[model samples]
Target: MVDDLALARHLADLADAITASRFRSRDLAVDRKPDRTPVTDADLAVEDAVRAALAEHRPGDEIAGEERGGQVGAGRTWVLDPIDGTKNFLRGVPAWATLLALVEDGSPVVGMISAPALGRRWEAASGRGAQAGPPGSPEPISVSGVGELADAYVSTTHLGTWVEHHSRESYLRLVDACWENRAFGDFWQHCLVAEGAIDLAAEPIVNPWDVAAVQVIVQEAGGTFTDLSGERTFQGGSALSSNTRLHDGALALLRR
Candidate 1:
């Protein structure tokens, strides 16, 4: 399991190399919500590199990536997001990341998130507790002890879907409940939860690749992860991560 975590982190490094080198290299020609070609190329390239690394080390393990889809192999599988925040990447923003996870049976046992542009990386195994830091200096980290909802700082990447699927009024209720709210979307918001910098992060829409690595990091950091309804599964497609203390309170406001 520890080996899987290490491999995932190493693969994240490989992904960072491919992505960081190409982040701002694209021409800023916003023809229509940013050209997809550059990010698509980078995505495929990173997925390919990860697949190749998996093939070499965990030869029998299956692979699933956002860009390349899936290829079954051994009992243990890896789910990857070559780039989690593609829009941000294409926009010359640093909110993107390389998300990697080892799913044993059906759950992620080892997860890693690398955002080279932000100079941050977080990695964890099922039992090993989470760790986060700059590119080099790793350290143990955990969620904050903010127990009151009114005093909690909260964030999310987007509000369109939340306002669309749920009610804008409900979304506003959540914002009103927190002391602070930020739209610091993508892996960074979740990382902030893991580092205890924020009390909660709620996203209206996401995917396994979007939240898998983050889920592991949050849980291992003494926090909790769940759908807006508080169900613990990436399949929910939306998440509400918190420092555990304020999770249910946030859930209550959202559910109301």
Candidate 2:
């Protein structure tokens, strides 16, 4: 069997090279998708680089990316979100990252997230524990032990978007229930939860590319990742990642 986790991390390295180079370029080009979300040249370039690498390294494997879509195959499908926080990258906020996940038999068995701007990267393989640290030296990571919602630290992307998605009431309830809340947004929040720095990270809306890699990382880090309805699939259009202790209570409030 191929070392899928190593391959995933290699892809992340390739993506970081492209993204870090153009991160704040004066001439970086930007466009808007039909959904009105922003996409930048860096995003397209990063995805193209990752796809090309996969084509050469694992040509038979299927691939799916945010910029260009492809079907998930039965054997292996590489999922890519070249830039998970495009808005942050566009604004030079240093909050963006490249996300790559290798899905085997419809489940992500290897996952890697590289945030060059933040000088951080995280990776996990099914059976191997999750890890995070500076790009070079990584240490094992796990979820926090916060057992109650009242003591948990919660995070989300945007309150306005959450409200617009018809989840405002429940989201507000979650925020109110938590001891602290921040709009830490995107992959960073979920990664934080995986690192035990936070207790929960959720979004009222998300795509498969947005959460596939993150789901594996969190799960491998001793947390639970699910939709508001408690289903553990990335296609649910929303995400709720938490240290296992707080997942049910948080999901219950979100469902209300």
Q: Which candidate ranks first by lDDT, i.e. highest?
A: 2
TM-scores for every candidate against the unseen true structure:
0.91, 0.97
Model 2: lowest-lDDT 10 consecutive positions: 1-10
Model 1 global lDDT (CA atoms, 0 to 1):
0.83
Model 1 root mean square deviation, Cα atoms: 2.9
Which residue pairs show backbone clashes in model 1? 60-74, 157-185
Candidate 2 lDDT over residue span 1-256, tens digit each: 4477777878888888899999899999999999899999988988898899899889889998989998666899999999999999999999989999998878888889999999999888888989999877889999999999999999987788887774778988899999999989999999999999999998988988998999899999999999878999877889999999999899888874
Cα lDDT over the full model 2: 0.90
Candidate 1 local lDDT, 1-256, one digit each (tens): 4477677777988999999888887543322323243445678789999999888998878888876778434478888989888888877888888999887766677889998998989988898999988866789999999999889899875668787766676689889988899888888888899999999998887877778788888999999999887898765878889999988778888884
How does residue 15 of candidate 1 score in lDDT? 95
Question: lDDT per prediction?
Answer: 0.83, 0.90
Q: Which pairs clash in model 2?
A: none
